[model samples]
Target: MPANIVAQARGIVKSFGGEKPALGGVDLAVTPGKVTGLVGPDGAGKTTLIRILAGLMTPDAGEVSILGGSPAQRLDSIGYMPQRFGLYEDLTVRQNLLLYAELRGLPRDAQEAVFKRLLDFTDLARFQSRPAGKLSGGMKQKLGLACALVSTPPLLLLDEPGVGVDPISRRELWAMVAELTKEGIGVLWSTAYLDEAELCDSVYLLSEGELLFSGPPADLTGAIADRVISVTGFADRRRLALTKALDRDDVIDGTLQGRAIRLLIGEGHPVPDAAALDLGPDTKVAPTPARFEDGFIEKLGGGPEGTSKLAAAYREIPPSDAPAIEAKGLTRVFGAFTAAKDVSFTVPRGQAFGLLGPNGAGKSTTFKMLCGLLTPTSGTGSVAGFDLRRSAAQARSSLGYMAQKFSLYGDLSVGQNLDFFAGAYDLSGGDAREAIERVTQIFELEQHYKRNAGTLPLGFKQRLALACAVMHQPSVLFLDEPTSGVDPVMRREFWTHINGLVRRGVTVLVTTHFMDEAEYCDQVTLIYRSRQIASGPPDALKAQAGALTGAADPTMEDAFIALIDASDANRDEEAEAA
Candidate 1:
């Protein structure tokens, strides 16, 4: 073993039921005093590899070691946070931290000091007394991270720690990871977000249980240096059509961003002749720095294949004339507490509208009302041309909904679940069969149709949920954090389906903690403290957020932080002036 290596795996192999190989001859190494990121799309064996390293599961074959010892035997020296961090929601934040501290065998005095430091680092001091169940999604993620950090182990394994966390919270968590690495704690972080890979000192790119690339982020880009270009005017139909027409070559890997497309061309590949394409005279093409996303997509062989049709189809949906979904003076109060106040918004037909806010910002409450699952305390609303309060069933009939958790029956087969949903929507016999077949193909669920739902992987479960939701071909779709625990590749695939649905005139209303996902929406409504604060396209929001943070080229993450910070500063100023 290398002297600085904290953990090492050689030729690891794992299989389930002797047929499905989860990890195939995988090799990984985690060094001490650095953050090593494992980046890959869903079903890429990230979680399986992490589990093997954490000693939670045994690999079918391979050598695994931690701190120069077998991970199973040296489990006490490592801290593991699985995708689901086994948090006891019933416990208070303090209690949860204390429980983990004790389990890790810290003395009372040491536990107190560690607990205080973790709470301060996670910024949960104000919510120490709150039940873990009551914490917002971001806060819960912080709490999970805090619990994992309680023992302060030298080797930390985190599986998608920032999956469903807000940008601010994600930043804080990464900061904590950096701090730990500085203290000589080895961290193996698994994430689907390519942006997060940039923060790591080293990264291992995994796909289909194979290691594609492993090195520093800088090295990854340097290897493909000067091969990326930013092409503007992608929003123009003619230009977009031309770009897609030329995308069949293996040399080009293009990804759309708003009105622009970032094309990753192979080294020495000739640039397209702008004049030949009839692109506008003002069409601007410039070399742009390669982001982690670009590098990952390029390495993965030109973004996901067979997804362009979905993208193009979604773009064809006409903007709604009347609001496909709307809330008018919607208010939800619990005794003396008000969850939502006068929240009103109009989601145009076929548009991808997003509702974003901190946990408990009344997003879920508003979503429930929009879905007709919960009636507003005082307000009138309509969805799909049906009154939310009086014609909920009619409204529901036109909408498809996927909840945060995998809500399908565990004991049933995937085909059975789909059949049940189809029948519930009143599609029978041949119609139901056709709907099932279409959705199965769309989600690539044909192979897993006969498999038990409970035995599927996280990504598969998410796919199944989406498949079920769309089985009825509803005109509107409501997704509540649908990609929360999915891997990046799977996340991209999921969005491809969403875009396809939208292009076919299906309105989508989604709420999510991932800020990057927020960028994909046609319009966004940002809620804070039960009130709508900012609403617009992501670019508009970014321009509106000026000079409030670290960099001038503020990303959606940076913009969100700045917006929230500015709101708080204004509140503080008002309080002082009073």
Candidate 2:
């Protein structure tokens, strides 16, 4: 190992009674004052490697060194924050910090200084007295990071710390980590987010259990530079165009960005012109900058092929003039705090609607109210033309819901879970068996039919959740962060099914923190601080933000941040005027 390397691993391998090893002959190094990104899909050995590096798990075979010493002997020199950080919900932020200080064996005299520095670093000083449970998702993440830094270890291990966090909070978290790295702390950031990898000093791309690529993200991104392009003039049929592009032999991957279709052509293929894609004569194709995700998908042998079979089996709903979903003056109050106030939106027969906002925003609360999971303190809503308050049961029966977290029975086998869901949806006998078989084939779950749901990879779990949610083929679907924390390829596959459903006249209402995902929605309503701030098509929102940011073209994330900042400024001005 080099003297400058903070941590090193050679030929590390691990297995958990599976036919394949969890980690196979992996090698990596982390150096001071730099971020080493551990990037991979689910079941790619990232967590296993991080656990071994943290001395929490022993690798079956490998030589691991931390701070120039064995991991077991250098435990005090590394700080590890796992996926679910251990934070006592009842404890105050200060109390949690003090607890971690004690666990790290810091002296009482040194606790106050360390706590103060971490609180300031994370910008959580003012909220130190608040209970951890009361904090927003982003604030909780910051407090977790602060606890991990109480001992000020030289090496920091973060395992998907940005998962489920909004763009604003994600940027803040990254900024905090960057500051720590400036103090010579080495950071190993493991994440499914490729954009986050683009920010690292260097990245290690892992697939299955082996190392696929290691070096600067730009190296991989540059490999596909000439093959990336964006196409316009699809008008309102962009989703259909994207679907068509993904089926092409030359197109490796494609996604909807505002009103444009971003495509990555296959290697050795010529840059696709508008005519080559069977697009209209007015369609314009122009070369675009390649992204790390473009390279990641290319390296993964391209994303799922063809259209979704699951969508093919969907039966179109009967024609109706009524909106599929409607919410008017909906409000929910918890004691003195209002979670959602005067939130309103409407989704047509087959449109994909999005609810987007920062953590602790009223988006989820409003979503729950529409889903009939929570009763609003005032106002009314409806789904599939059924009143949410007067006909809640009928409204619920007309919809399918996939929660933010996988809500399937983990202890049950894949087949068992499918059967249970089918029965719950009133599917029985031949119908139940047919529905289960259909989902099993479409989701490629036949091989894992007997496996425990809990042991499946994250991607498979998401697929199963969707399968369970849609087996009965309800007229409307409610998805809460359906693609959170999944790899890019998996997300694309999930959206394929969703778009297919939308095309079949199945309305979808989704809430997500991923701004890119929001672009897929026909219309989006952004809720901030329990009030609707913006509602329009993705391109319109981006145009509004582009004018504000003075950018020729602005991304959904750029628009999201700009809109929120503008809103806060207006609120401040209103307060000053008063």
Candidate 3:
């Protein structure tokens, strides 16, 4: 091993059973003083590999090393932040950081210095005394990072650290990581976001537990030289039609971007005939540099990439004429605290409506009220025309809900859980059996059907939760952070399943922290501080926010951050004036 090498794994092979192999002969190396990204979709074995390196789990066959020693023997030299960092919400930010610092056996003076620097970097200095549970999703993520950095281990491994964090917080976290790298701490960061992969000094692309490519991001782009083109001017409808038409050709890979599309053609492949297109005269086509996403697509067979089949499925619900859910002047109060105040929204039939906000911005409270789990202190609402306040059960029966946590019977097998959910929905005999079979096959759960839910991986558990929520095939579906902590591959697959459900005419009301996932929604409602700050298509919201930031083209994340920051500034100024 090289002198700078902090972690190394050779010929790693892990299997859950005799049939399915999760990681196959994978070789990886992480160098000190650099950030190495482990990028892949869900079920790509990112977590499994990271777990092995962290000494949290053992590989069936592999040679693993950390800090020039065996991983198991050098556990104290590494700090790992799992997808779910197992944070204790009840603790204050300072308390959490202090606890982790103590666990790492840091000296009192050193711990204080580290804690102070972390607070400054994470911008959590003012919120140190606040309960972590009360912090926003983004803030919680910052705390998680702070806790991980408490000891300043030589090797830091992070698994999807930005999964549910807002754009501002995500950027801040990346900045911290970059600073750590400069300090000569070897960092291995795993994420599904291709855009994030570009920030790493080097990347290891994994697919279905197999290494697809390992090199600098620039090298990956160079491999697909001169193949990417950006085309604009087709509405989503025409874009979809065109994508389908172009997808028929084996040599092309296309992905939708706002009102435009990016196409990557195989080397020497003929370009599509422009005259054959139904494009407007304003349509513009230009060569564009291959991005990390482009490189990922090329490695993954270059199809219209973003979220996978599951993502598309989750995003594809048909348009609805009838109001599936309606909340009029909804308000929720806990003593002197007002969680949601005068929040109102309506979801048309078969539409995918998104609820977005900071962690304590009342998004979850509103979601619970809409689902009939929490009665609003003041308001009138209905789901599938059933009164939300008075007829909670009736409204709930017409809707399916999947909470943030994967809430399934851990002791039961996947099949047993599906059966239980089917029974809960009142499906019987053949109907229950058929529903179970269909969902299992669709989600590719057959391989793990007999496995206990507790024993399954995070992605599989998420799939099972989704399957259970939709077993009765309710007209309306409510998903709360369904993609949280999921790997990129699995997230894509999960969205594909969701899109399929939407095609069958299910109305989806989803609350998620993933800004990219917001784009997949037909319409989005941004809830900030118990109020609707913005509502519209992703493009429109982005455009409006772009007008303020002076960015000609603002991404969803950019728009969201701009809007929130602007809102907070306005609030602060108002308070000062008062």
Best model number under lDDT: 2
Q: Quote each prediction's TM-score.
A: 0.91, 0.98, 0.87
Question: What TM-score number comes out for model 3?
Answer: 0.87
What is the Cα-based lDDT of residue 504 in candidate 3?
A: 57
Per-residue alpha-carbon lDDT of candidate 1 for residues 1-578, written as tens digits (9 for 90 to 100): 78899999999998876465888888888998999999987778899999999988999899998988998789788988878757999999999998988888888878778888988988999999999998887788888888888877889999988877777778888888888888999999998777889989899998878889888998888766687766666453422333453344633455445456556776566655445334567667788788787678767765554243434423244555888988899998988989989999888787789898876788889899889888899998898889987888999988889998889998999999999999878899998988888777767888899999998978899989988887777789999999987765566667666765666678899988777777768788888888888889877777768555546656676667778778889889999999
Per-residue lDDT of candidate 2, residues 1-578 (tens digit):
68799999999999998899999999999999999999988888999999999999999998999988998899789898888756999999999998999989999998889988998989999999999999988998899999889888999999999999999999999999999999999999999878899999999999989999999999999999989999999788887898888899989898888788899999999987889888776799999999999999998899876487988998988878999999999999999999999988788999999999999989999999999999999999999999998999999899999999989999999999999999899999999999999999999999999999998889999999999999999999999999998888999999999988998899999999888899899999889999999899999999999998898989899999999999999999999999
Candidate lDDT (C-alpha), each:
0.80, 0.92, 0.80
Model 3, 293-390: lDDT tens digits are 76787677645332234433343345557788898999999999899999888888866788988768898899999988888999988998899867
- What is residue 22's positional error in candidate 1, in angstroms? 2.4
Worst 10 residues of 2 by lDDT: 303-312
Candidates in order: C-alpha RMSD to true structure: 2.9, 1.1, 3.8
Q: How many backbone clashes does candidate 3 have?
A: 25
Task: Identify the superior model by TM-score, candidate 2 or candidate 3.
Answer: 2
Q: Flag regions of model 2 displaced more than 4 Å.
A: none
